[model samples]
Target: MDVPALNQTSASLTLFCLPYAGGSAAVYRDWQTRLPGWVRLKALHIPGRGVRYEMPPMHGWPELLDLLVEDVQSSVSQPFAIFGHSMGALVGIELAHAIRSRYGHAPIWFGASACKAPGSRERKLDWLSCPEEEFFDQMRVLNGMPEELLQNREFMELVLPILRADFHLCGSYELRDREPLECPMLVLGGSQDLEIARSSESLSAWARETRAPLERRELDAGHFFINTHRDTVISLVADSLARAFHSRGSGVLPSRSYA
Candidate 1:
């Protein structure tokens, strides 16, 4: 795992970000510029991607979560928050749970974006079981990457394994049991992403995992809306960060939404 430090501010709240399936920390390269000066963004680059490309992806939850927990444990420097998209959202839950259990500090807030609430998935998708052609077909349906990259054999060869590993983690994951988190939860779903969870109502299932109120909002796009509707997504998160910090009577605001 690789986490590059960005937005080093003294009075800051660190926001540890995780990327969607098949995505690297590169996806959040511009976030540091958009977030306010009081927030430090540490976008984790999971192994086998970004600067860690030589490494292999972990296909199971236990190993992946262990790495995630370790990465956060070593990198976090202050009161922190977590924001993840798609597969990252699921990973964030386990990461936060682990952080609280082992380190005894829950993030001030949890932001889950473009993912269904755990256990609410409509159906299991074993992408690993699919033949190569069929698996790429699903990729076409997801449309996360550019069509040209899908056509580029060199790029596809490098990325397909990572995607497969990530999908295996997502499809096979089960939330058997865990205690609710102490901090608040914010859930963001794409308005058109019914293939995963039916709708925002389905996203609301996240309420079961947090002691604080769950805030669910649906953006006007599909599963990959984080790109198509990037500005809106970022602004919503900024506003939420402001609200969460202010609610705690923290003297500093973390996002420009308050300004």
Candidate 2:
């Protein structure tokens, strides 16, 4: 399949961001202004959310990846990077594998935020079988759902299914062993994210799967660190992209030596 048409400007790097489950492209709306002139930012909007609300949400992983790979390959052409949070992180990693296998182009850098390392234990929660109120409470703990929606029955009717489906997809993922990726992996976690382990050391396992460098940074926020620490998160990502751009040209992608 042909890749989607890329929107290009003069920027030296293009970043394709994937949002967390139940999130839309709008989640990264302000990122363009925050990034340096050398970098261009674009967000991939999955169906059943945002403007594509008419389309059904994708439940199968392979189908979802195919659609994303087609769209992303069409939409970007410059030296590019990817940043995915939570469910998006898994998507980003799988997309990396797809791009390499199909197009032979690898992202210069990959930012996997708020996700366990590939092949890590999957946390299972049967939200579908739980009471509606109980399921909402779990979402509240994650800090993404707005208070107004939780109280409004009409709004809950529309959003709850999408949320449940997303949670199910994430919780049910099965990891198959594969060769290490040949690109840099930047793993970021929030200090207070209850779902992820407290120690940043667990993130280092991601290094074993990449030939390029591995870097880990912990933010002093919870699961939604992107929202809670926007400035800090953006700055760190910008700096890493700049460094990756420079390193790519120098023919020295940093070594993945665990600290």
Clash statistics: count for each candidate: 0, 5
Model 1 lDDT tens row, 1-259: 2222223353558899999998999889998888766677899878889988888888777787788888888645468899999989888888888888888888888999987788676445677677777777777766676778878999888888899888888888788687888778888887667555545455778888788877888887888887888888888887787678657766543435322
| Candidate 1 ranges with C-alpha deviation above 4 Å | 1-11, 75-77, 122-125, 146-148, 197-201, 252-259
Q: What are the per-residue Cα lDDT tens digits for candidate 2 across 1-259? A: 2222222242366688998988888989998887766566878878789978887877667888888888888644557789999888888888888877788777888998888776774656685567888888878878777888899999988877777777777777777677777667678889888777654555677777688898889998999998889888887887677567667763333211211
Task: Report the alpha-carbon TM-score of model 1 versus the true structure.
Answer: 0.88
Please list the Cα RMSD from the true structure of every candidate, rounded to 1 decimal place: 5.3, 7.0
Q: Which stretch of 10 consecutive residues in model 2 shows the poorest summed lDDT?
A: 250-259
Give the TM-score of each candidate: 0.88, 0.85
